[model samples]
Target: MQLAANKGFATEKVLNLHEISHSLEFYANGRLVRNDDGRQRKFQGVSEVIEFVKRNGGERVLVVLPLDRVSEMNVDSIEPTFIADNGALALYAVRVR
Candidate 1:
């Protein structure tokens, strides 16, 4: 969260989901990618990965579209196209097709 903020990628970050749960959004390369509420799901508490992905969900759509909506809680932007989703497969197929 600190790194993202320092980099200007993360506009604001919360230590806990109390306020964020009301509304969560993710961004990537200047686009709103993911939108979710981290409450009432396995992704409880505060996780920057969850926050980041939720922010970039759509851009990662090809590779991140199929995973459980809240699966992002388990990962961060550590790898390129890191979150594997059926959308990832579709991305390859689209290129080939």
Candidate 2:
């Protein structure tokens, strides 16, 4: 999230491809609760998710999945900007055409 913040991407706009919930409860006070609408669709693959985000005004993506999973997907268009020491996390800058 820090990387996204540094790149000026709004936290509300960061789409999680693996998210399955329609809404997230961020806070609650008695009967008052705050929720951010979640991604309702289940993406079949990484490429599809990237395209979806790109179409919705996203410029970058932070992947936290295993490397093997990501390696099996088509990510030729996305550029790797940062990789974690454990290799479990990666941040990519989506190329816009």
Candidate 3:
């Protein structure tokens, strides 16, 4: 989160790829809200998630998963912009193409 902030990316523009449950919390309209309902979209794979992000005006993707899982993602439309020292977290910039 701090890295994205430092890079001047809006919080709304960064897509979290982690599994989100009903306990997720975020701010909407300047108020803290909880995702009690399972209304959040879940993607079957990384490709779908990237497409969704592109459709929704998002430009960045934050991946927090094992290296093997990351390797299985279709990265044809995105490129790595930042990678953590532990190789567990990565930030990708979505290509316009």
The TM-scores, one per candidate, come to 0.20, 0.43, 0.51
Residues 1-97, model 3: lDDT tens digits: 4454467543433334554322223422221112358355434566766676677575454443344456644565665555442455444434434
Residues 1-97, model 1: lDDT tens digits = 2233343434322222222222223322222222466232222432433454466441221121222333433334333223222332111000000
Report lDDT (Cα) of residue 88, candidate 3.
Answer: 50
Candidate with best lDDT: 3
Kindly give the number of clashing pairs for every candidate: 10, 0, 0
Instruction: Report the number of the highest-TM-score candidate.
Output: 3
Descending-TM-score candidate ranking:
3, 2, 1
Query: How far out, in Å, is residue 27 in model 3?
Result: 11
In order, the Cα lDDT scores of the candidates are 0.28, 0.42, 0.46
Ranking by lDDT: 3, 2, 1
Off by over 4 Å in 2: 3-12, 17-42, 72-74, 85-93
**What's the CA RMSD for each of the models?**
13.0, 7.0, 5.0
TM-score of 2: 0.43
